[model samples]
Target: MIQASAGRDRIGRTARLGRLRVTKAGQALSEGVLVAVAVVAGVVVAVVAPAGIAVPAAHGAAAVSLLVRARTVAGRVGLRLTLSAISVAAGGLHYVLVDQMGAARHAAGVFPPVVRVLACVGIAACLGGAVAAMVMAATENGTTLIRLRRLLDGWLIAGSLFTVGWVLLLHRADRGGDGSASFLGLGRVVADILVFGLLVALRFCLPHAQRTATTVAVLALAALAAGDVLRILPSEPGAWDGIPLAAAGSLVGLFLVAVAPWLPGGVSVVGFNQRMMPVIGVVAAFVPVVFCALAIAAHTVAGGPIDTVMSALAGSVLLALGVRQGVIHADHLRITHESVVREDHYRTLVDRTSDVITIVSPDERVLYVSPAALWVYGYRPEDLVGARLPLYTHPDDRETLMQAVQILRQDAESDIRGPGRRVSCRVQGADGSWRHVESTINHHPDGLIFISRDVSERVAQQVQLEHLAFHDALTDLPNRALFADRVAHALRKRTTDEAPPVVLFMDLDGFKEVNDSAGHAAGDTVLRHAARRLRASVRAGDTVARLGGDEFAALLEWEAGAPPSSAKEVAERILTALTQPYPIGTMKAEVSASIGMAVAVPGITSDQLLHQADLAMYAAKAAGKGRIRLHHAEPPHAHRGTPNG
Candidate 1:
C-alpha cells in the first residue's frame, strides 16, 4: 500500500511539471502572435490603407488589443492599464472626429461647434495619456529624470520654432477672415504637430532597452501627424485624397502601439532621435534661410511689400545663425583631424621600431603583433597573431617562461604590483634558427604587453669573452686557471664508492732548445701539434691544459671499479706522442716529455694534487727524459718511474 501511494505521488509531480512547461511555451507563443498582429496591422496602414471608416476601426481595435496586453505586465500594472484605457478612448474619439469631419465636408453644419470642441478635447486627452504612459514605463525601467533634463535645450529650440510657425499661420488665417471650420482645422494641425514633437522627445529620453513599446507609440503619433498634414494640403480632383492615406497611417500606428505591451524587447527603430536629433537641429537652424528664400520668391512674383519686409527679417536672422553654425562645424572638423593625425603618428612610431611588441591574453594567446616582427623574427605580423606564445618558444625554456607568465597573470589579478617582469629565452624564428630574446612583460587590465628585443648576438659575444678568459691564447685549450677549476669540480663531485680522478703533469724535454735553435714561430707550431696529440690521447671527459711554456697537464675521469693501470697506460701514450717528430715550418724537429701522475683521493685538495704531480714530473726528469713517474703517499724516495726500455 505504501509503495502504491509513493507511485501515485511521483505521477502527480510529473504531471505538474509537464503542465508548467506547457504553460511557459503557450505564453511565449501568445506573445509572438500579438507582436505579429501589431506589425502586420501597422504595415497595412502605412502601405495600403485608404482614408475611410476602416482606418478608424483598425486603429480602435489595435488600441484595445494593447490595453488588454498591458494587464499582463507585473510592474505598475494599474498605471499601464489606466494609460492604455485612456489611449483607447482617445483613439475611439479620433475615429469619430474623422467621421464627423467627412460628414461636415459633405453637409454644412453637420459637425456642430460643441461636437468639434469635444473631439478636440478628446484628441488632446488621448495624446497626453499616451505620452504619460510611455514616460511612466520608461521611468519604471530605471531611467532617471536627470537624463531627461539634459535634452531641455533641444526641446526649447523645437518648441520656439513650432510656436512661431503656428502664430504665423494663425495670423494669416485671421487676416483672411477664415471661417470656424478653418480655425478648427488649424487647431487640429497644431495639436498633431505638438503631439509629434513631444513623442519624438520622449523616444529620445528613454533607454534603448525600454524603447520597443515607445517606438510603436511614436509611429502611431507620426501617422496621425501625417494624416493632419495630408488633410490640410489640396489634392488633384478624382485622385486618391489625403483623407484615406491619413486614416491608414493612423490605424497602422495605433495598432502597433496597442500590441507593444506583448512585443519582445529587441525591436529597434533604425533612425532614432539620438542620430536624427542633430539632423533635426541643423534643419531647424536653417529654417529662416528657407523661409527667406520663399518670401523673396513670392515678392518677386507678386510684388507685395509685406513679403519683402518678411524676407528682410528672415534674411537677417539667417545670417546670424548661419555664421554661428559654421564656426561650430569648423571647430569640430579641426579637432577631429588633429585626433586622427595624432593616432597615425603614434602608430607609425611603433611600426618602425626594431623591437617586436606583442599583446597577449591571459591564456598566453597572442592577440596582436606589431609590424616590426617582420624584421626581428622574419615573420609578418599576421603569422604570429592568434598563435600561442609557447609555440615559438624553445621546449626547454617554455616551463620557465610559463612560470613567469603565470606570475604576471597573478599580479594583474592581485593588489601586489611591481614593474614589468624581465625574462630571457630562446625563440625560434621563421628561418628555423633559435634567437635569444630578452622580453619584458607588462601586465595590463585588457591583456599583457610583451616588449622583446633580440639579444642573440650580444649573448654569443658574452660567451666568447668568458671562454677566452680561462683558455690558452695559442693552443685554444684550457689554461692553468680552468684546469685547476675542473679538478676542483671533479673532487667535489667524487663519491665514496666512485673512482677518484687522475691528474697527469708533463714538461717538454727539448722544447726550450727548439725555441733557441729554430725561430719562436717554429716552437709555436710544435706546441700546437703537441696540444692536439695530447687531446687525442685522453678521454673526451678529461680536461687538458697548458700551464705555461713547455708545461702541460691533464685531468682524467675514470669509471668506478676501473683498474689503476689505466692511468699509467694513458701517461705512457702521452709520452710516446710527445717523443714523436713534429713538423715545424717545412722542417723536422724532435721533442720528448717527462710526465708525472697523481690520483685525487678523499681529503686531498686540487692544489695538493697539482704539487704532487709537479714533484713526480721533476723526479721523471731527474731519472731520464722521455720517462713516466707516479707519485706515492710517502716521501720523494717512494716515487716510482718507468726507465727507457
Candidate 2:
C-alpha cells in the first residue's frame, strides 16, 4: 500500500514539472515569433519605401503597438507606455511636416518655428514619461523618506548632466549673438541629451527581465538624440547630410520602442533604491566638478572669459551636490548605529566560562585536573587526572601539543615555562566529541602547571559562520569567493612542465523558465539537484561551486603531461549528469548545462582564466545549449554529444 501511494505521488510530481516546463517553453516560442514578425515588417518597410516615407510609417506603427501594450499592462509601466505612444505619434507627425516643408522651401521660414515647437513638445513628453516611470517604479513599495531620496537622486543626475552640457556646448561667447533660432536649436539639443540620460536612469530602476527591453528602448532614444544633435552642429552648406541619418535613426528608435513591451518581465531589482541610490548620488556629485574644470580650462586657453551664467549654474549644481552628500552621511550614521545596537544584543546572549586548570608532568601526563573537567570535557576530575595527553588530544593535533610540551620542558630556567607560552589544539571529550582547547603552560618545581579552556562552542560558531560565507546556503556548494580562491591557488602551484589548470564556467539552460513557471522553491530544488550532480561528476580533488543563481563553476588541476582532453572528458560527464531529469516532489524537472573551459597559461591570472571560460560558456549557449566549449587565444573549440548514460 505504501509503495503504490509513493508511486502515484511520484507520477503526479513529474506531471506538474512537465507542465511547467512546457508552459514556459510555449511562452518563449510566442515571444520569438512576435520578434520575428516585427523584424520582417521593419526590413520590408525599409526596402520598399523611401527614407522619409519609411521613417514616419515606422513611427506610426510603433506608436500603435505601444498604445496596445499600455492597455495590457497597468500602473507606472502602462503610464510610461501610453505617454511614449503619444510622444512617438507626435514625432511621426513632426517628421512628416518637416519632410513636406523641405520639399517646399517657399514655406520654410514659417514651418521652422512650427517644426521646432512640435519637436520640443514631443521631446518634453518623452522625457517626462521616462522620469515619471523611473520614480514610480523605484518607489512603488518604498517609504516616504526613500521616495524622497530617490527623487533627489534622479534630479541630481539630471541637473548635473544638464549643467555640464550647457557649460561645455551651449554657453559660448562666440554664440552670444546667434539669435533665438540658434538658442532654441541648442536648447533642443540639451533637452534631447537630458531625455537620453533619464532613459538610462530608468533602465536600472526596472526589473532584470524588463531591462533588456529597457535597453532597446534606451538605444532608440540614443538614435533619435544622435540624429537631433547632428542637425544643429555647425557644418558647411550642403556638407552636412543629417536628414537621411535622422530618418534612419528615427525608424530604428520607433520600431524598438514599439516591440519593447512584447518582451517578458522578470524579477525587479531588490533593494535597488537603497543600494544604488547612494552610488548614483556619489557619481552625480562628481560630474559637475570634472566637467566644470575642463570647461574653464578650455575657455581660458581660447582667450574667453568664463560666463557669469555658467558659473552660477555650476554653483547651483555644487550646492545640490553638497546637500546630497549630507543626506548620504546621515543615512550612514543611522545604519552604523543600528549595527552597533545589534552587536551589543548578540554580545549579551553569549555565555561566559571559567578556565580549566591542570598540572602536567614533563612526560606529558596530566598529574592534576580541575573540577571544571566535567563541564568542559564531559569527564570527572578523577578520570582526567594521571591520563596521558595523547589519550585526550585529537589525533591530528597531538603533534602540536607534543611540540608545545617539548618547548616547555626544554626551557633554560626551571621557574619559567618558555616565556608564557600558549598553544591551541583539538581535545577529545569523554563522550567522543571534539572541543577546541586553548592551554597556557607554566613551570613548577614538581611539574608544569597548565590552564586550559574549552572554547568549542565559540570556535564552532566561528567555523560555521566562515563556512556560510564561502558556501552557498541552498546547495552547500563552495561559492564564487571560495572557488576563485582555489583557482588562484591552483594557478600559483602550476609548473612549467605540467598541463595548466582548467576553469569551467557553467550556466544552466531553461532554469529561469522553471523558476518563472514553478516558482522559486521549485527552482531551488532544481538547483540543489544540479549542484549534487555537478559534485559527483567532477574528480574528487577538483572543486565545484555554485557561482550564484543558475551559474556554476569548477576548477580542474592536472598532473604533469596530462592532456587537455582530460578536461573535455570531465565536462562531458558533467553535461550528462546535469541533463538528467530532476525529481522535485513527484514531478520531474529538466535543465541542461552549457559549459565553457579555459586552460591556464604560465602568466595568466585567475580572473582572466575565468573570463575566458565565461566567454566560451556564452558561446556554447549561443551555439545551442547542452554543449561544451574550450577557450583558446584565437577561437573557442566547441563539443556537443548525447551520451547513452
Cα lDDT tens digits, model 1, 603-635, are: 788888888898888878988768988887644
Candidate 2 all-Cα RMSD: 31.7
Residue-wise lDDT of candidate 2 within 1-645, one digit each (tens)? 634654564465456656866887897787667655655555455555676778777878888988898887776667767766776676566556544434543554676667656655654555555555555555665445455555555555556666556654564412533344344445545545555555555455555545656566666676665555544443411222333454445555667668776665422331254444435544643664577567667767989766776677667667766776677677677768878998877445422336777888777788877677778888888987788766578887777677656556655232233454687889878888888998987786656777788888889999999999999999999999999999999989888888889999999999998899888999999999999989899989999999999999999999988887899999999999999988878888888889998888767777778888888898888788889988766322333322222
lDDT minimum window of 10 residues, candidate 1: 142-151
The C-alpha RMSD of each candidate to the native structure, in angstroms, is: 18.1, 31.7
Q: Assess each prediction's global lDDT (C-alpha) against the native.
A: 0.68, 0.69
- Local lDDT at 78 for model 2: 75
Question: What lDDT, from 0 to 1, does candidate 1 have?
Answer: 0.68
Q: Model 1: what TM-score?
A: 0.50
TM-score of each: 0.50, 0.44
Report how far off residue 602 is in candidate 1 (Å).
2.3
